[model samples]
Target: MKSARMLPVLVLAWALALGNILTVGIAVHAESPAAAGSLAAPESFGSISNPDQRSAAFFTELGKVLTHPRCTNCHPATDRPRQGDLRRLHEPPVSRGPDGFGLATMQCSSCHQETNFDPGRMPGHPLWHLAPAEMAWEGKTISQICAQIKDPKRNGGRSLADLIEHIGSDTLVGWAWAPGFGRQPAPGTQKEAGALVEAWVKTGAACP
Candidate 1:
């Protein structure tokens, strides 16, 4: 009897999760070159008349990008960075030391170069490093990310307005949209995701 009751909830959760995946897929398509000219991206959070619901949807959509391998690989819960779509342990082994850079002398920049196009080696960034401890997103859901993003303590002291700018224009965040070579880009372009962030912020930055 208990199993039957739990079944419905489990099924509902699965359905919701699948629906989220589909929604992200469609959203990516909508932002592609084919749909670019016709689609008016979200202007602001409050621009949606249904502020609360739109806020929810915006987070849901943004979650698709956040939960993707590109983002999660770096935001891993463990000290070690993950790799590939499989989310396996990084091959050579690495750890996010005190500075969130890497284990002492073995900094990430030692290998990853400024650009990726090459799969033979890890890519690099001028500031290539893991996110701060507070920003870990590896095991989190969209709702949890949303809540954390709104907290001054968790969000690196960023205000709601600051978040809009960061998500929309941050160079690092933009990189996910155009990760070259072997890596798969995040679901949507940074511009589109930024628009969603803007819309979510305007809609009172409601948490999921």
Candidate 2:
């Protein structure tokens, strides 16, 4: 009699456990894509009525790419560039030489070349090198980065118009998206990032 009574309860418990697992699995599956990096389209922010607000909104979105490890690792606040997703200090302890390449003894071109070396998992581009120390983005807020970018003294003397070309057409900058295996790419496509830059500039390049 007791066993018969327990059977219904056990069945109910098993069914509830299975339902919970399925629900959790479904939720995870649905959320994973959003967790992966993405960028908002430039047109998506057009609904904002205020131009400055719209500009700032665009830049804030662009910040996702600017602040990603792929970008920041090479834009370390110090002379030493970082490497990898963890943003760890670079191995072999290389310093940015006078031209943004590493020290003469250990230049960036010493390893990085015109293309990725998948066997060694090293990323490369024909123009591989660190950003000038004046343009370092690590440890900066989006607004601070925006301000820095607008300042020619700190922005490699780039005008607002020049920024669009650099961000949109510069192959070296585009390399962030194509970093090889074992690396997380910057959010969104480079073209998308450049469109955001154009929109931001058109709307006044307001800082967030």
Candidate 3:
């Protein structure tokens, strides 16, 4: 009878101990550096008020995607494109041949097709090739990319309006969001990226 009575108290003590542990865990997480919040929303850029500052800030936000592996891989400073999130060099010794396509024997179209093939772990889009040599973004600062993106001579002759359209609606850019075979997608949706580009242009297209 005494043992049975002690069982209730023991069970109650364990429950209290578990509750305390959970409470401490939550408090620790709340205080931890790893618990920082996510990226600021696009609307938050409006808080800058200064058009130049806000515009530059907008591009900084869009920079999240522009610098991501999906975009940067093809925009390598060297002739070879990188692969995967690690930004490793292209395997099988590919190079950016004339017209940004591979050599006749090993064209990008030889592997990357119209869409991603999950079975092959190959990411594909109809336009899967290197950006022009002038448009190389690898090893450049976001500010540099920002400036180059706005320059007609460096940006493949695109006007600011053309840039807005390209970033805002280009299907090739959209492919960054749906990279297949278990790769990490870019920071946000392509539409969200486009909205940032549009906002950046509308405000002043300032470089960070």
For this target, which candidate reaches the highest TM-score against the unseen true structure? 2
Q: Residue 49 of candidate 3: its Cα lDDT?
A: 74
lDDT of 2 by residue, 100-200 (tens): 98888999999998999978989999889999999998999999999999999999999999999999889999988888888878888899999999999
Pick out the ten consecutive residues of candidate 2 with the lowest summed lDDT.
Answer: 29-38
TM-score of each: 0.75, 0.85, 0.80
Worst 10 residues of 1 by lDDT: 32-41
Best by lDDT: 2
- The deviation in Å at residue 65 for candidate 2 is 0.3
Ranking by TM-score: 2, 3, 1
- RMSD of candidate 3 to true structure, Å: 5.7
Pairwise lDDT winner, candidates 1 and 3: 3
Residue pair clashes in candidate 3: none
- State in Å the error of residue 57, model 3: 0.5
Whole-model Cα lDDT per candidate? 0.79, 0.91, 0.86
lDDT of 1 by residue, 112-155 (tens): 77776465745556777888788888998888999988898987
